[model samples]
Target: MRRLPLLLLPLALAACNGGTGTPVTIDVKSDDGDNGSFRMENGTVSIKGDGFQGNFRVPQIKMKADDVDLDGVKLYPKSEIAGFHITGGDKPGNGKDGGKDGSKGGGKDDGKVRIDFTSPASLAAVQNWFRDGFTKKGFTFASRGDGFAGTTSDGGTFTLDLSADGGQKVKGRMEMTGS
Candidate 1:
């Protein structure tokens, strides 16, 4: 696995009205695979998967999204197991000055964040949700043969594979590979 270089990726999220915005429940199921379920409520998020289970309360988050704030919303996973959170760690660097954090080695270094999830929202609504959300933060997107591809203002790239689950649920896979 490679580490994505840190760049000025252009992606965005919008801020809701109140300080305590509407909390979202993410169903961890996808069109191609099913991871499990993630219920984010009150201040804690509970995870249930095929071979793993864990629960942790989120810190008090008064996060308000800015047009250019990539970390406006944050997810802090408390599970000891690896791969629970998105965006694995970067590989340690070899430097004379020891610029890299050596303690971060031996962890997942895949330069990708893959999330599969479903919601009761319609496919169109879900599509528009991402489309509008990212474009506002300055990501240029185009429809691809596989799905929708987008590049951030700083050239970071991501792909979205989405499908309707035949019910009202919209299923999607979000793979983010960025520098």
Candidate 2:
């Protein structure tokens, strides 16, 4: 029976490829039966399935934290916004395609943004910084098994997740929705 699952694995994975021909690689390691990880690297996108966390890195897309408005929330000191996507307002560029809409435009806050970033700081520090910033802004923040989530008084929501990068840095992604 165990071998049946192993045989079916390829089929399951093939469905994930989406026929992009971009080449997808997945690595899964489990300590027990339930506690394990699933990681996939496909071109510029990397995902960790255990926690539903991932980030996309594209060379053509250029951005900074200042370029997008996250209300009054602040990012960790020296953190870099590696990729972003904004819609619903006059925001610049798409996080998935780098302004593929052919508009070098700017707009008002539509209260929706997805940001992927890297921080030289440790994972714990990054979480603390966001928790502090959001709470002060009146957002209720709580820790999940993998990361943190919060919501604003007016219906805004924020999510954060960071994983160690096998070195001194951490890579993470954050998303906010609602104005």
Clashes of each: 2, 3
TM-score against native, each model: 0.43, 0.49
Best by TM-score: 2
* Residue pair clashes in candidate 2: 84-95, 85-95, 90-107
TM-score of predicted structure 2: 0.49
- Tens-place lDDT per residue, model 1, 108-142, is 32455555445455667666766666667777788
Maximum-lDDT candidate: 2
Off by over 4 Å in 1: 1-110
- The lDDT values for all models are 0.45, 0.54
C-alpha positional error of residue 57 in candidate 1 after TM-score superposition, expressed in Å: 15
Ten residues in a row with the worst lDDT in model 1?
3-12
